[model samples]
Target chain A: MTNIKDIAKMAGVSVTTVSRVINNQPYVSAEKKEAVKRAIEECNYRQNINAVHLNKGKTFLIGVAIPFSNHPYFGLLVEGIANAAVNNNYKLVLFQTNYEESREIEALMMLKHKQIDALIICSRICGWDIIDEYVSYGPIVLCEDARGRRVSSTFIDHYKSFSIALEYLHNKGHHKIGYCIGRKTGTNSKQRELAYRDFCMKLNQPLKPNYIFYDCFNFEDGERVVKRLISMSNPPSALLISSDQVAAGISTCCKEHNILIPNKLALMGFDNQPIAKIMNITTLEIPLVEVGRNLFLQAIENNDSSHQEISVKLIERLTV
Target chain B: MTNIKDIAKMAGVSVTTVSRVINNQPYVSAEKKEAVKRAIEECNYRQNINAVHLNKGKTFLIGVAIPFSNHPYFGLLVEGIANAAVNNNYKLVLFQTNYEESREIEALMMLKHKQIDALIICSRICGWDIIDEYVSYGPIVLCEDARGRRVSSTFIDHYKSFSIALEYLHNKGHHKIGYCIGRKTGTNSKQRELAYRDFCMKLNQPLKPNYIFYDCFNFEDGERVVKRLISMSNPPSALLISSDQVAAGISTCCKEHNILIPNKLALMGFDNQPIAKIMNITTLEIPLVEVGRNLFLQAIENNDSSHQEISVKLIERLTV
Candidate 1:
């Protein structure tokens, strides 16, 4: 119940003097400091840890701004982050923005208020203008896309990964390759879409606009995409998907329809999630734990001057 | 940027009087209230909405204390709570304690500080004495068990559910039945263990000590349990597991070993999550969304009463 005001009154000094003494800052005489310390000890005053930490410009909390926490990709990312956080003696306070502008802004405001030491955005939903504005407040790190932004970043290259999946299918004598991606709004999806477009243009392959399906990046979304693709006028022999969950959906649907994988319809996916292994869907295994570890390191260092973008590698499986 | 103190100083009034005017509380002079309001308007002071909401003794933030958020069962529970919270115009703040006593105490302290309006404990890790101390601060609703000393709870009857699963297997002519439970420290697991004991005693069947396996309610844990059971001299023909995630692990392990379900080993699990449906694991469907709704209703009512318990029902599947 004891506050700085109580310590100041007992020490016969102003609240500022008491604050200086507690923070170990300069300008307080030894006598006054001793009196303040004695008064604090007498009252057993417990200084607010978060408040004091803020005043000293060192909030121990790290803010993670993400869209959702339930999906296997994001879930694994969070698990990696959480594991590293526990090891590094740090705590995470999540901000589930659900891709809303207002909620994303709230996470940025925490930096200005000195509530969070730094921020790690897994996937940005807002435009770069807003992201640029918040970058001045504190250290801001991006997880997925760099977007050629000035802020520090750590992510896998979606363009190259998507190209590799498609190129592999094309080389296997499967020229008619379709694709499924996450929401078109995200930077990662945009990159993947660009990769898909450029690859089709170069190969002189017919680019069917309806071949691309964009929605949530989950198993159910993948399943829906597969349904749409299967019912298409000219369904491709091979499919390139954004995430493993989506691949699972397509695989499950294929099993139900008796469309055998690799033989009937080949598939390649991204994010070699556990289910991808169980279902034997060839995928690009982006090091999720490493991504989380690097993000935490960047956040704790509190430096945005240097940015790092990790590369993605393909994990071969039976689906292809 | 402006706070109550700034308005009070400009209006030549105490901060309490300014708060009284802002909150529209009685016992403030008309002239002073008018002056405070005028100063607030002149300074363009916008109250911190979150702080003002806190001042009204209703933050609309429900703290959900769970062991893990990545698991399917807990994830579904979170989804249920989040859906209910959206309906009620509330937000959920997840506090992943990993069943640590210190973390539970921190959640209780958040309630004391009026940070979170109420608490929905999906898993109990706090002692009864500590829970008793927290009940005075705000509503604390239990979701996993009903054996609270004074707290109101919405929980499935683990004992009855376990007994039914065992009895169903017994009726199918399986005398040697195995059991896989969660950590024994939890009330739900304790009840299930007691039920197992009672069923064995009543049937006058020899209880195979090696048939029981205990682990965390996770996929890997279930697989590990099955591995140990199959290695035993005589493994039970039917196994009763505590969670769907664990059953998935066991199912995966069985598939790897080419062991047929229902024919080689009958498996019955708890918490009929979506994954259970996909894997065809027979389980008791604990109505999670209903539990969330009931707990939210209990929290809003703020009734101080003894614990409440909910019932569970078995859902037959191909695994049985």
Candidate 2:
């Protein structure tokens, strides 16, 4: 309800004089300063922090565009971002798009409107076209995939990791392997699918349509996919899962059916999440916390700059 | 940066006349309106939205005080709150206190300064003195414990759930049972701990000092606790864990050590999260999503009212 102009007008001075006094930018006469103070006291004026922060065009608020914060995968990633943000004297503002196209656009709009300094998209399944449209607004980094764009991204090498798991199973004389992959639209999932297809084609193996199950990158989907495999007349001897949570679900299903792991069936998982470590589910461990930290740092530095891509690693365990 | 006073002063008119022009509140002459408009344009001013928001003492920003957002326990809670806040046209401003006393005070300061409309404390490990001090600033709602305060709260009956768990174990002939709880400083954990003490005392069972472990609430802590239990000459027949993640860790450790569940050593967990369902973890389920939603709705209403508290339930499963 109060502003610099109000104080200035009341003090019989220009708005610039009030601005200088408020910002402590100097070059103000003592008499004018006293008059401005009197006017400010009388009007009960308060400075708008958001407006001032906007003028600098840097809010020190990093927006983390996560699909869902409740899931284990993103949960770790968010912790990484938040931990990094606080250390850097920045705060995190979560923008859960739920993979909705409109919400992604809204995240971009926030940058254009100077609401947030940068954005980190973790496990987004949206198309590249939608992202490309808003790439110019601010810094946009991908957590799971490189996207092949100039954008700075932090991701594990999904193709290589998938190949490594396949090779491990292949070396164990398992020609028939069922695969459970998360939503196929994203670059990461696509890479995994491609790896699976390419490996089978190269080895002259027949790919079973029923063996592959599309999942939502969660434990329930892992259970659902495992059930599909169990119900089939001929299930694959080995399975490669999208995540550790999925592997847990599959392991639970196996226990229910009395199918002992590595004895009756072999399994491998990805993301090497903490659960993976606990369950001893064979998986390719990616530096999730590091990815998150690097993502935030990238966002801060490249707030108004271009994009870049980061890579991932593989960790082996006993499941296979 | 302009206010009603500025326009009135420049137009040589009363503040009431400027307010009438700006808000179209009626009874403003054509000359006065023209003068006000000209003065406003010359000043290049914008209304202080924060000040206007504060004028009504409503920021439309709800504060969610949570311990950790990176874990499934609080992550799900935050998700439910965010979803409800979005649907209701309100923004949930995360105030992650991490159970720290200083950050808790920061949240109270925000409420006192009218930066947040109300506060929804997910769990109170902070104690009653701090809570009482902030209660008068805005409406406060507790998530999992009443704290015996007059605040509105929504949570499950920890005592009932613990009793159910212990009774199930008792019925299963488990004379030697170990209880693993979170940090005892929190109200929720305190309830769980009290339940353990009372039930053990009523059953005429002496509590083993080494059988109880206090964790900081994470997967690593769960794993560490299990390691300690496994090292004992006469370990407990069953273990009750504070969270599903912790249970997963203990289960993983058991698998590695060739220990069996509900067979060689029974295990039960709390919070029946997504992983718990997949793992068939026998425990009492706390409806965290419902807690989050109800607490947020209470916060919205709290914007104009006082404190209130709610109730909780126990969803039983097969862990015992």
Candidate 3:
């Protein structure tokens, strides 16, 4: 088989010119391109390194394993990831696992097979011990703040975020507060719950079991949680919600019942999403997009294992 | 260099077994797999066909070009496409273009370079003429209904959808209807405009310039649009919103002004997004996920050139 140099020689062009033509670069003249094509045919040349493949040792592809995309948290995170990816001339491969363990493993397998240069687990289902094994193949970054020295991660300190929200509510003279949670055992949810419990304990406020709502992420969950609160003989004066969407849901139900927010049932939500701004709902603003961008950047740039903690702020508005 | 056959012969295993070991298939015995790796190392073999790469002539990767993933429409479409891609053992490369033409062309370039097997343009920035050139490289599918036979497309007929929406509004005794639009020059927005104009003309109702709200897509846009309508001396009795997101925005603004939905101002929205369902806003349900699934299936399964049109339905709820 003839090599590219032999073809270049036969075509009366430089090796770089032949290489440019093969890579589909635009500078070569049509006449020179024709000559190169003819030489390639005459010599029966086959370049094993095709333009189809990305540059050697750099696939320039990133895999993101998120439980779902339509949700507010993941969507905001992806928005940041996608922008950073396009700027860096990379593409995002999303694995919508619906929080299933097997679905999450598919992205890990892709990393093992070198299908993607790195993996970003947005909402991890499995522990770091299992994920640390794939670090040898490529960078494996977790979105949650994990205590893994061998792995890289970017996360909002959910504990501090919850504390900010809880402190804000307590400052407003709301001694009794109920909070909504997404998952019963999710790392972020657990952190938020711990913060709530600790805050109540320090204040000498009763931490009632009925005040804690679990598995609350969406609008309906928030609505149902609020309705359950409303039916209680002694409902908490204020509510710390998990997400803006759920808060919005609570607001909707309140409207139907003629229950004025803050006065009747004060509410503070998480993830200061656009709707939070629109609805004027006070929330602990977790910069999810920034977390995603930083996670991807760290995976690509920081080969040395490191962890990044994104800070959160409390934005005051009408609902709270 | 030694090949798989030589390694197989040295290990006393069939070439199939050697290939299976290289590909990381599960059924191979641990002893046999170890022997093949040893034989491969001894011969100093370098196969062009590596496990890192997909099978020869097939990357099993599809590129999807969308303006943004954070939006409800694109998010739903991606969910469908991602599900299909995972089921087919393929991966999705998202090109979040933010509707930029240059960004869209990047996905096309990936197709040209054989990085992805096909390209799915969810919302096109460029026309078919430019995209037709890349059809020879691989399949290019459009998310919107296009007048291109060479390329396969799966889309909700915007014209038909608007017609259905308009007729329903008209039947409900809405003579003067205001409509919101995302882009003044977008294909879907334009199609919707034409439908509104045609419907009014056929019904002997005049199409008012003030009734058409341009550059509205998100919740904030809808709020601003409705505020503009309220200040007008002659506001339309009903509004046909471009998206459920915009409708949700409109709903938020309405609540702020103490305005009643359906009773004071009748409204219609497009894309029955989760928010829309939660808000109980009347909307035309565009099967965005189904469109995504059919688009991927068509690109992968269809060899012969054809077009598919996904239908939309109006889901009657509160605030129609």
Pick the TM-score winner: 1
TM-score of each: 0.81, 0.74, 0.79
After superposing candidate 1 on the true structure, give the runs of residues whose Cα lies further than 4 Å from its correct spot.
A1-47, A50-54, A57-59, A88-90, A147-150, B1-47, B50-54, B57-60, B85-92, B289-301, B305-308
Q: Name the candidate that leads on lDDT.
A: 3
**Candidate 3 residue pairs that clash:** none
Report the C-alpha lDDT of model 3 over B80-169, residue by residue, as the tens digit.
Answer: 888887677676888888776656765776788777888989888865545665778888888766655678888777888888888888
Tell me, by DockQ, which candidate is best. 3
RMSD of 2: 12.8
Off by over 4 Å in 3: A1-56, A203-210, A227-237, A254-260, B1-56, B204-210, B227-235, B254-265, B317-320
Give the per-residue Cα lDDT of candidate 1 at B5: 56
Ranking by lDDT: 3, 1, 2
lDDT of 3 by residue, A1-320 (tens): 24455677899997656766876877899999999999998876655424323436666789988887678888999988888887786788878777765466657767876778889888888655456556788888887777555668888888887887788888898888888888888788788888988997998877898998888878778678867987899988898988888898888788888899879989888889887886689998888888878988977875767788888888989987
Taking the tens digit of each residue's C-alpha lDDT, what string does model 2 give over B1-320? 24445566788997555545655656778988999888888886444444546566565567777767687889889988878876664555565666655455556555765656788887665567556656777788777656456676776767777777888788889989888887756766777778888888998988787888786377667668767877899999998887887886777677778877778788788777877766667766677777778888878773443343434334555555
lDDT of candidate 1 over B1-320, digit per residue (tens): 45555677899997656756765668899999889989999998755554556457676667777777576677667666666665564556666777766566656656766767888788878777567766788888887665635666887888888888999999888889988877877888788888998998998876777788877477777668767767878888999988887888888889888888888888988878767876778998887766767776666665775466778888998987
TM-score of chain B of 1: 0.81
Per-candidate iRMS values, in order, are 10.9, 12.9, 9.3
